[model samples]
Each structure stands twice: as structure tokens, then as C-alpha cells.
Target: MTKKYAIIDTGGKQLRVEPGRFYDIHPFTSMGLNFLKPNTKISLCRVLLICEGSNINLGHPWIRNAIVRGRVLHPCFDKKKIIAKIDSKHKTRKELGYRQNLIRFIVDSIWSNGKELVS
Candidate 1:
């Protein structure tokens, strides 16, 4: 059987999510990061689109009453990147590192068009 899925945008990034799967995503908002601890469950209402066996619902930006229920699996840091630059003639060198703050989530259910599907 084919499972349904949805596309969602959070923290300025787009993600394809399916039920019963875990995805590491950016914190939904800057301030929301401060209060959301691990194991907290949240309802994401920013559903861009939903598809189930070719039955698709397109939204004008987002669908009304479409929500994805997920649990915060953990709060962690994402990948780290190192940037380095060197100038041979001027004898200048610079190095910098960047890491993104993120949260891991387990999708529990998808509610679309007044119907709920368990993941």
C-alpha cells in the first residue's frame, strides 16, 4: 500500500514529510525554539500540499485546517561547515565555522480535509 504524504515549509525550508517517519527540521520560529523541549508534541498547520493515491489538495500558500501532528524527538545541532580563505601574497588567512540549530521530529499523524491518517 502506498502511504500519503505532504509538503510543508518550516523555518524557511521546504520539507516532504510522511507519517511515522522522523525528519530533522529547523525550529519553526526563532522564539519557538526557546520554549520547545524534547518530547513536546506540536501541530504544524502550514501544510503546502497533500497527496494520497493521486488525490491531491493544493493550497493557496497553505491549506485551511490541514495539520500535521508531530513530536519533538530531540534538540540538537545540525551539520558543521568550515570556511577557509588564504592570500599568499598578503599572508592573510581566515577560517570560520558554522552550525545550524535544529530539532528532530517524528510525524504522528496527518490531518487533511477533516480526515486524520495515522503515521
Candidate 2:
């Protein structure tokens, strides 16, 4: 049977997630990372909508009780890289560096279409 699914918004982006799948999410600061602890059960409360069979449900603000659960697989940072620029025009110059602390998760299950499927 074709499984039903939902799309959720986290960290300002949309993710098409399914159970048993591992995916990366946007990085967060150390202080803000508490919300994404490893092995933590998080319900994606900001569901944009859901699809089951041929039926679709869209939320104005967010889907009510539309929960997608996932476990944090790991919390880590991406490789760092230098961002630099130099211009001889009026001696303009700029340099910067950045690294992102991303969260990896394994979707455990999704509750929708009046049912739950574990992956």
C-alpha cells in the first residue's frame, strides 16, 4: 500500500520526511541546540499539511494534532570554510568564517490519516 505522508517546516525550511529515514537539518547555536537533543522524541508540531491516499489536509496556521515523530541521531557541526573578498577599489576588503551546527535525525513514525506507521 502507498503510505501517507506530511511535510513539515523546521528552521525555516520544508522537509519531506518518512519513517526510518535519516536527514539533515539546519544548524543551530549551542544555546539553541537544547531543543534537538540526541534520542529525543520531538513532535513536528508545525505541519504544513498532510496527504493520505487521495485526500489532502492543509492547515491555515498549523495542522492540529498532526504529529510526526523523529529521534535525533546526532548533533554536530559542518566543516568550516573561509569566506574572503578583496577589492582594490578604495582598499575595500572583507573576510569571514562560518560553521553550522546541524542536527541529524531518523524519522521514527508519523501519525496521520487516522493511523500510525513505524519505520
Candidate 3:
């Protein structure tokens, strides 16, 4: 299996990820209300770094030969979240709730240096 690196953009954030590794991505809803489905395939167009074995290539805007592939595992929310409000003098208190949509992806491959990793 060939080894390579790829850069991907998720939820307006760019990430450098690899295969066999898992990463947290922003909720699909963040993209737009149109994207509310779970476990959907979304292409990440931002390529930043591609490292293959010993050869490494970097993108000016994006590496010409780098491509990263990933799969959306599931749609969920963070385990721990907190929202609170308080007023000291008035002794008033309020609390808010939050549960953000999150996606877990498994890096399928990082194509760079004219090579691709086996899935």
C-alpha cells in the first residue's frame, strides 16, 4: 500500500488528514439546510499537503497532484457541552443548551506523488 497525505476542507475549516485515522468534522447543517442527511459523501476540495513515503509535495494554492478521500461514518453531537448566563447584582441566572452536529470520517486514501493508498 502506498502512503500519501492530502488536505481537505470541512465546515469551512481545512484539515490535513490520513487514512486509518479518524477526525471530527463540522455538522452537515453548517454547510446549509439542504445538507441535512447523515452519512453523506461530501468532497473536500482544499488540498494542502501530500506526502508519499519519502517524497513530499506542497500546494501553493493546492497541490496539483494531491487528492484526499474520506467517508462520513455518522452524524452526532459532542458529548460534553455547556451554556450558562448569570447576573451577580440582580441574582438572576439563566442557562442555554447546545448540541452541535458532528461528523466522523475515516480517511480512505491520500493520493499524491502519483501514487494512491490502498483502501
Candidate 4:
């Protein structure tokens, strides 16, 4: 069987996603995925490209009926990043830390034109 994958636009980023795999993405309000409980079913419709077997479908912007179905695994925070600054002349020091909110999900399948491309 040919391995299938797709390029999807979400959370202001393009990601290559495959079925039955887990992926982490920044939480975005536009997708209305924030605050979702675990195991919640979701369908992402902004597929930019899809490849199945030897057939590839490239959308001008987005395929008319192409959608990727998945379920939310859970919500989590990414690794913390620390930032530090120091000024000798000013005799000042500062430090900051940040952790981005992220959501993990498993891609169950990819579909295009009413056909299941990947399972």
C-alpha cells in the first residue's frame, strides 16, 4: 500500500500530517478547537494537498470537498523557553520564560471527493 499524507493549513502554519499519527499544534481560536475535551472528534477542512497511492490532488487554494478527520488527544503545554538579558553599563538583569499552549490530536483518516484516501 502506498503511504498517504497531506499538507494542511492550521494554526497559521502548514503541516504535513499522516493518518493514525499524533501531531501537536498551537491552539488557535480560529479553528474553534480550544477548550475541547479529550477524544473529541474534529474535521479539518483546509487541506491544501492530498496524496493517495499514486494519485495526487492539488487544490488551487483548498479542495472543494476534501477534509481530514481526527480526534483530539489532549491539551498540553510545550517545553518552556527561557530568555535572559543583562546590561553591564545599566547594571540591570532580566529574565523571562514562556510556554506555548498546544493541542495533540490523532489523524484518523484523510478523504477527498467523498473517497477515503488514507485510513
Candidate 5:
């Protein structure tokens, strides 16, 4: 059997996802989905494309009735990013650090057209 995978849009970004794998993603704040508790079930419906073996399915913007289900692992902070600015002529230096909040989840299943693919 062929493994199924999909491309999905989340938090203004596109991600290629596969079932049974864990991924970190930016929380959807507009939908009030930040800081979700661990083990919570989440469903992503903005499927851009789906591929299985030699067959492929595409969406105009998003495929209707296509869903990817996952289980939340935890809320965590991403790696720190540092920015430094220096003006040697003036003997001035500035630095800044930033880290983004993210949620980790493991994909459980992909469903479309009444068919379910579980990893």
C-alpha cells in the first residue's frame, strides 16, 4: 500500500504533513486556539493537496470535506533568534532575542470523500 500525505495551510503558512508524524505549528489565535492543552484533538481542514501512490488530488484554494486529524503533544517555545546591531563609529551596540510559541501535534488520520487513511 502507498502512504498518503497532504499539504495544508495553517497560521498563514503551508506545511507538508504525513500521518503519524509530529509537527510544530504556530497556534491559530484568531480561532482562539492558542496554548491548547496536551492530548487535545485538533482537526485541520485547509487541505491544499493530497497524494497517494500514483493518484493525486488538488484544491482550488482548499479542498472541501477534506480533514486531517491530530492529537496535541504540548505547547512549547521555539528556538531563540538573536539580532545584533552595531555602530563601531559611535561605539553603540544593540541586541534582541525572540522566540515563538508553538504547539506540537501528531497526525492521526486523513479523511476525504468518505475514505480515511490512518497511520
Candidate 6:
């Protein structure tokens, strides 16, 4: 049998998702502290497409009755990345480091056409 999956759009990116899988996604970190807590349930209704077995449902932008649900596993910052700049004539160099926060989500289920699929 063919595997069931769905494509979702979030944070300006698209992701292929299956049930019961965990993914790390950009949280669009804000200036202040985030209010999302661990184990909290989250729903993403921006499903772009859904594929079940050999059947495919496409949406102009987003499917009307498709939704993907997940649990917030954690919200944390990834490893720091460094940015450096060097000036030859000035003989000066500078370096900066930054960490971007990300959200960890474990997909719980996917619903399409009023039917739910849980992996």
C-alpha cells in the first residue's frame, strides 16, 4: 500500500509530514519570551496538499477541511552561528554570534475530508 502524507506551509517553507513524526521548525522568534509551553497541543490548518494512498487532493492555496495537529515537544534555541567581517586596508575584523529559536513538534494526526489518520 502507498504511504499517506501531507504537505504543509509555514514560516515561508513547505514541509512533507506524516503522522507521529517529530520536526524542528523555525518559530519566528520574537523579541520577548514565548508563551508556548511543552506538551501543549498545536493545530496547523494551512495544509497545501494531501496524499492518501493513490488519491491526491490539491488546493488552490490551502485545503478547506484539512488540518495537521501536533504536540509542542519543546521550544529552544539552536547552536550559535558566528558571523565575521574583515577589512584588509583597515586591518580590522569583527565577529558576532547568534542563536535562533526553534520549535519542536511531534505530529499527532492528520485529517482530510473529515477523516483522521494517526500514525
TM-score of each: 0.90, 0.75, 0.73, 0.90, 0.91, 0.88
Candidate closer to the true structure by lDDT (higher is better), 4 or 6: 4
* lDDT for each residue of candidate 5 in 65-111, tens digit (9 for 90 to 100): 99999999998889999999999999999999999988889999899
lDDT of 2 by residue, 1-119 (tens): 66677788888899887778888887543336777677976667788877776778898867887788888888877889889899998798899999887888888887865568432
User: How high is the lDDT of residue 112 in model 3?
Assistant: 63
lDDT of each: 0.87, 0.77, 0.69, 0.88, 0.89, 0.85
Q: How many clashes in each structure? A: 0, 0, 0, 0, 0, 0
Residue pairs with colliding backbones in model 1 are none
The candidate 3 region of ten consecutive residues with least summed lDDT is: 29-38
Q: How many Å off is the CA of 55 in candidate 1?
A: 0.6
lDDT of 1 by residue, 22-56 (tens): 99988865447777788898888999999887688
Pairs of residues at least 3 apart in sequence or in different chains that clash in candidate 5: none
lDDT of 4: 0.88
Candidate with more favorable, higher TM-score: 2 or 3: 2
How many clashing residue pairs, candidate 5? 0
For candidate 6, lDDT tens digit of each residue in 39-94? Answer: 88878899999988878999999999899989888887889999999999999999
Q: What is the lDDT of residue 11 in candidate 2?
A: 83
TM accuracy, model 2: 0.75
For model 4, what is the error of residue 57's alpha carbon versus the real structure, in angstroms, after optimal superposition?
A: 0.7
Candidate 2 global CA lDDT score: 0.77
Best by lDDT: 5
Candidate order (lDDT): 5, 4, 1, 6, 2, 3
- As a TM-score, model 4 comes out at 0.90
Off by over 4 Å in 1: 30-32
